[model samples]
Target: MAGASVKVAVRVRPFNSRETSKESKCIIQMSGNTTTIINPKAPKETKSFNFDYSYWSHTSVSQNYFKKDIKMK
Candidate 1:
């Protein structure tokens, strides 16, 4: 296991029916290799994490883009 590198990724999924019904806003955001999550109670409070990759699948358009991007890579 010496000299082995680890890769990690995070994805944001679309809201479910329950969440949609409650009109919940997405608190997660992804850009390049960074993923950020904002605190609902405090909009200014946000935490960002870096990974090998970051995916956005919270919408149909993003899902399609992700699929195409993966295939191209």
Candidate 2:
């Protein structure tokens, strides 16, 4: 059998009601294919990761996932 590569992606969702009630802020930011996560407790600390695709579901605008973006052999 031929070796296959797996594609990975990340999706961000809006805060829940409980989180919003606590006045929590979002610390996730996506730029191009990179996603950055900042530590809320430690503002100076941050971590970034890259993915094949990313979906942001926290906005009012509509988003669609295109099938052409994924290629299978």
Candidate 3:
């Protein structure tokens, strides 16, 4: 890894829209191996809601309970 000039990994997580009805648009940009996630269509948060996007998401639960049907969904 001596001559490495770019990041080894790039991870991104999209915004959870279930908390509110308003939708959002996001744009992802990458240059020189650097990636940036931008939400160009960011909407206003009008109400209070709790969404579990951390660890207990649907995809994770399905993966843990059923390992054969996971495809990054």
Which candidate leads in TM-score? 1
Lowest summed lDDT across 10 adjacent residues in model 2 is found at 64-73
List CA RMSD, all candidates: 4.4, 6.5, 12.8
Models 1 onward score TM values of 0.75, 0.72, 0.26
Clashes of 3: 0
Evaluate all candidate structures by whole-model CA lDDT and list the values in order.
Answer: 0.70, 0.69, 0.35
Q: What lDDT is reached at residue 3 by model 3?
A: 83
Model 1 C-alpha lDDT versus the unseen true structure: 0.70
Q: Report the C-alpha lDDT of model 3 over 24-66, residue by residue, as the tens digit.
A: 4334433333344444555342222222221212223333222
The digit string of per-residue lDDT tens for model 1 on 1-73 reads: 9999998877777889999999998887666676678899998999989888766767754543233342112
Candidate 2 off by > 4 Å: 60-73
- List of clashing residue pairs for candidate 3: none
The residue pairs found clashing in candidate 1 are none
In candidate 3 the C-alpha lDDT for residue 62 amounts to: 35
Q: Can you write out model 2's per-residue Cα lDDT over 1-73, one digit (the tens) per residue?
A: 5898888888777889999899887787676667788898998898989888777765443333222232222
- How many clashes does each candidate structure show, in the order listed? 0, 0, 0
Q: How far off is residue 9 in model 1, in Å?
A: 1.0
